[model samples]
Target: MKSFEYLRPETLDEALAALSDPDAASLGGGTNLLDLMKLGVAGPERIVDLARLPGLDRIETLPDGMTRVGALVRNSDLAADPGFAAAFPMVAEALLSGASAQLRNAATVGGNLMQATRCAYFQDPFAACNRRAAGSGCDALGGANRGHAVLGWSPACIAVHPSDFCVPLAALGAEAEIAGPSGTRLVPLAEFHLLPGEEPHRATALEPGEIVLALRLPAAAAGFAGNARYLKLRERTSYAFAVVSAAAALRIEDGTVAAARLALGGVAARPWRCSEAEEALAGKPATAESFAAAASIALSNAAPSGANGYKIVLAERLLARTMAAAAAGTPAEMPALPGSLMDDTGEAAHA
Candidate 1:
């Protein structure tokens, strides 16, 4: 790892000031940043540690009936918070479905949001990657890219954002609370991540000196609590990144869908929210037919960027199954394996 100056700021102002340096990078829990540093994928001249900053680690309910989650709140803590888990069960499930318990214990909400894509090309310093170095060619385009993006990809970059937490958050319409040199502002979680249109290097909406302070979920998001699910399909049963994942939530009234929220992960540069599918679900019966139709609509615009055409079919089926599971109602208790498919006896199926 490259040597760098470390600055532990006791206040947000100090942290923002330290980040004004063009070569400075913010450190949250260092779960992802540390690994990237070791791989030489990231080498910052200065590290502005936000660990000492106050008031960025609390979880509170706002007066406007929204739940505010501190950016520094640990992933494990957020998933384990009874109030948060009860209010946003799908979000909790997504958190649990992420990395191992030890990593989750150290991973903060902000770190997870800012985590880089798990593209092999982007991680290899010697490889050509537009995301890693703009104007440089993309080797993943002609290389091993079976796991690359199937939606919202361009010739410049075909990497997907690998965040399970952000899928459900995008579905629930969460908002990011950002603090910067220009002051504070709120940005919708769906728009926080930028697509790789041409500037693949600019991955997020954050400015040079901006930092995400927290994430807020409106109270209406809680209405789908009883009927929400996050399902993920990975190459392995554990400690693996998702090949495809879906977060589905529906508010059903008298066997009809009153409202719906759906988002897909591991298929795009951002958590792909299916607004059209959600609209199609409204006023429709909470049945397999309705879910299948919605799922089709969700993947209507999806096209494989490389040899990953299978992902489109897989994603469509997964979304339909996920919506069906949501309509079946959320499990009373979180599954032994949070995002895994369960058998008839309510046990997680090894398959």
Candidate 2:
């Protein structure tokens, strides 16, 4: 084991001071950070614990219809909040569809937003991964890339973001509240996460020592009496990383779509808001055919890998099914799909 220094800061200012050092990192829930550190995928000389920071875990509603969620809020608590359930069912659904109960209880909102990708190559330090070592070359590009990216990829990296919360946040037009040594600022959820180009190490738009304080979701769209769906298509049914997931909020009028917000996960380097799919759905009849067509528009630009070429087909079917279910106002069971990977616990791995 590698030796490291640990500091528990009583205030955000103290934490910021520690994080000012390039070799120091701030720990929120330590769910992802600690695992990566143990695997030698991430290393920091010193770790600043922000658990003592003031007013970072509160959740409240604003005068507007928007919900303000603190960065330090636990995933389990966030999902169970009555206000969150009433105001943002999509967000709640996304949270509940994530990891096991234990993990959800320990994971924080800030850590969820800042969590690294689940790429097999990137997680295992023994493998040659560009994300772990600069200019080492991405071995995932040609080896076992079934669960990697199909969208927003670059020559340097093709790993996908692994945040369930981020997908719903993007579809709901959530904004991030950030504080740093300089000052505080709000960034749109779409712009908060940086796309992979040449720099795979740089994840978010946050500058050095900047910390996310809260997430502010926008007011309701024109519609949504109870019409929103977050669908995850993973290898298993539940408690697994998504293969090609989608979060869609639709406004339907007279059996036609008036407006829509569609965001995709597990297929892109970031939570991909499919504006083209939204545009295609608008002014079109709310039918299975229309949903399928919209999904086609969403995946038109997808660049599939050698092993994951089937994602394109799976994504379309998942999108169509989710849209149909939402339109019908169906409240599905926790594990709805039969033979789902979510149910394949301790079973033999499928080839």
Candidate 3:
């Protein structure tokens, strides 16, 4: 890895000042940043370590009843928080489903939100990638792109966001609290990630010198705790990036869907929220047929960016299955293998 000047800021102001240097990059858990640096995909001239920033590792319920998750909180810590897991089980499940135990233990929430796509082209310094280098011409466009994207892709890029945690966050209407030179602001998590249009290099809504402070889930988001599920399909049973994933939640009243939240992952530049699908589920019976219709609507506009047309059908079926699992009610305890379809049977699918 290229040598860089490292600064451990004592305060948020110090961190922001350090980041004002355009070549400086913030380091949280160093899980993703370090790897990118090693691969030579990213080599910032300076590193501003945020580990010493105080009060950014707590999980608390705000005065307004919203759950506030500090940006520096580790993934494993957040997933294992009793109150947080109970209130937002699907979010917890999504976190646990990602990476391995070692990674989850060290990865911070802010870093996860800032992670780059796992697209091979972007990671390979030798490949021509629009996301990695503006106007370089996307090699993935005509290369091995069976897993590129099925929605919200442009000729400039076909890479998909790789965060499992963000899917549930999008479904539950989470908000990101950002701190910058101009002070703090709240942005909807759905808008935190930008879709690749003509500029694939601009990935997130974060401005220069801005840092993610925390993520807040509104009090109303907890209402689906009893009926929320995050389901993922991957090449392996564990420790793999999702091929397609869905976060589904429903508020049922008298066997009817009173409200619904749905989002898809590994298929778009951001966690693809299915607002139309959620609207279709309202007042409908909590049945498989209702879920199927919603799923169809969710993937209606999804056209493959490359050879991944199968993802559209796979995403639809997975979404419908996720909705059915949500309607069945959350399990009393987290599954041994969270997000595994076979876990629904209350038996271990792998040794």
Candidate 4:
């Protein structure tokens, strides 16, 4: 095991100051970060613990009906909150679909949003992973890639961001508030994540030493909460990472679609907001045919990898079915793919 200095900060300023060191990293629930450290994929010189920091645990309501979610709020607590569920059931569904009840209790929203990818190559220090070391080749390119991304992936890196909460958050047009060494700033939640473009190592748009304060859910989106659903397709039926997931929120009036918001997970480096699909569903009848058409259009631009071409069609199926269910204001639907695709626990079977 490696050794390092640990600093437990009591204030946000102290936390920010500790992060000014080039090799310092923030410690939240430590569920993901600690695992990476133990695997030798990450070894920070110093760990700045923000567990005692005040103001990051509140789930307060703003005057405009928009909710302010503190970065440190526990996943289980937020998911079980009736008021929070009433306001954003889709987001709650996304949260509940993550890791496990035990992990969720320890995981913070901010920590989850910053989780490293579960790509096997990225997790294996011996493998050539672009995300682990830029300029190093990405082994997943032609290696075992059954669960790799199909969209927004570059030749440099095919790894995807592994946050379930962020998919619906992007569709709802949420905003992330951050505090840094200089001052506070806001970034659109949808754009906060980065694509695996030129710099595959840079995962998020957050500059060094910038800490997330809270996430703001827009007040105007309250109406869409009633008919929203999150569907995750994993190898297992339980806590495994998504093979393909869809977050669908439909606003139907009379017999026609008034508005629609669809975002995809497990398909790209960031949560993929389907603007074209939303536009296609906007005045169409709330039916499966309409959903399928829009879903196909959403995946039209995807370039699937050699071993993952099936994901292009799989994504379309998940998105289309999810949209039809959302339009009917149905309850959450669990993904039921063939059992052979995943092992007994429900994660993808490594070929």
| Each model's backbone clash number | 0, 6, 0, 2
- Which regions of candidate 2 deviate over 4 angstroms? 221-225, 330-351
Candidate with maximal lDDT = 3
At residue 33, what lDDT does model 1 achieve?
A: 94
Candidate 3's residue-wise lDDT over 152-252, tens digit each?
99999999999999999999999999999999999888889999999999989999999999999999999999999999999998999999999999999
Error of 1 at 249 (Å): 0.6
lDDT of 3 at 186: 95
Error of 1 at 52 (Å): 1.0
TM-score of structure candidate 4: 0.93
Score residue 303 of candidate 2 by CA lDDT. Answer: 77
lDDT of 2 at 276: 86
Model 1 lDDT at residue 126: 97
Candidate 2 contains a number of clashing pairs equal to: 6
Model 1: runs farther than 4 Å from truth?
342-351
- By lDDT, the better pick of 1 and 2 is 1
Candidate 1 residues 1-351, lDDT tens each? Answer: 999999999999899999999999999999899999999999999999998889989999999999999999999999999999999999999999999999999999999999999999999999999999999989999889989999999999999999999999999999999999999999999889999999999999999999999999999999999999999999876677889999999999999999999999999999999999999989999888889999999999999899999999999999998888888888889888888764211221111
Pairs in clash, predicted candidate 3: none
| lDDT scores in order | 0.92, 0.79, 0.93, 0.83
